[model samples]
Target: MFFSVVENKSMVNQSGKTGKQLKMTSYLAQEVRLARRHEEILSQRSVLLQQMETYLGDKKTKKTWQTQAADAAHKRNAALLNDIEAAEKKLQERVYLLPHPDTVKLETLYWASVEESLPKWEEFLLGRAETPIGFKKMKSAKWNISYPEEDSQK
Candidate 1:
């Protein structure tokens, strides 16, 4: 999931940075670096995929890419693909710059009030009191995704 503070997008696209946007520039720089790395990995993975496709399409060239070699290459390609996907996912999470000082204070207070009030009304409003269970399930569901080895290391 991607999250960003307000005014972040305009700051990112602007060439000339004002005092408030300097932090955003640095955040954009980090995102750019990650994006480049993601693209490079994707290109490398694409080549491997194309090679596998070629091997699959042409049966006459069996000696060129043997069965065992193709299987090994397929494993390598799968690993590379996983890496590419991970990188792409990382690219989605960016460092968002906070808005101006006064705006921040105002928003903070507003959200604090919302949080303070939410719990009291949460049950009545959040429950599917009138709606069907199936409809609510279709609208929202909990998700859990695992990266076994990678998550263990972290």
Candidate 2:
């Protein structure tokens, strides 16, 4: 798994699964919200349809107009509902060791990249020993750290 020491930055840990569950939870929440929005829009359209039917009633005209509006609303509703179902399917397909969304604080969007690279990270380390690297194998490496620029910079 991986972790972040600050906001909007993430580093993969041993298995690159650090914020995986949190990332999934965030994505699922987004899908669910979109689904709910669709449901709300459908509800609103239904209400408008009923109102129009009541207003345009002249017996024969009532049947024709109501049918048209209902048909359109039905199609749109079906599409929106399908989106919800697809989102749910994705949510169900995934499995994570630590599925805690409660822990997400600073790094919200950053974890998305971390989750994306997790499988590759695991594959990369597959040939290595199961246990962590021994001190004997340690080596020094160069580093180039970045910093946020101040507004005072022209």
Candidate 3:
């Protein structure tokens, strides 16, 4: 979840530690991509196994041909399983290389402090002031604001 928060380029740029933030973002993205690839490989293996099972179960197929097909399918599945294991190991390695969550949180807080020290920082603050208490709770806030271009005719 913290990784997802850091994926925003604006946030990373505002952090004042652009290099480190970008590096972390890149590694997190790579990890997510690898995870998706692992899932895809697993799905492929599942489909292959299912097809092989169906073929082998067909009553019309000759016994000798079925035996040969089964052997080939077994080898294919074994190779796929090996691939899955390799991917799992790589994923684990990536996870191990990531910084501790608490460290990341501290870094994030530091970035927030940096932002808070900048001019006009109050304009970026969330929550409404007119509430029974100090401020009304907000479900979400948008940090990246864009203004429309002014027309030359105006």
Off by over 4 Å in 1: 1-20, 58-154
Provide the RMSD of all predictions against the true structure, rounded to 1 decimal: 49.2, 51.9, 50.7
**lDDT of residue 33 for candidate 1:** 100
Cα distance off (Å), candidate 2, residue 114: 99
Residue 61 lDDT in model 3? 64
Question: 91-147 in candidate 1: lDDT tens per residue?
Answer: 655323446688989999999988986666566588835443333444333455576
lDDT tens digits, residues 1-154, model 3? 3555445544546547655567878999999999999999999999999998888777446787789999999999999999999999999998899878999899999999778764343544534323333345665556545556544445
- Residue lDDT tens for model 2, 1-154: 2434552146335665545656766889999999999999999999999988777676668789889999999999999999999988777765354456765543665698678766656654796434333224334443544456743463
Q: Which ten residues in a row have the lowest lDDT in candidate 1?
A: 132-141
Please give the lDDT score for candidate 3.
0.75
Candidate 3 deviation (Cα RMSD): 50.7
CA lDDT, every model vs. true structure: 0.73, 0.70, 0.75
lDDT of 3 at 52: 89
TM-score of each: 0.25, 0.27, 0.31
Give the number of the best model, judged by TM-score: 3
Model 3 poorest ten-residue lDDT run: 126-135
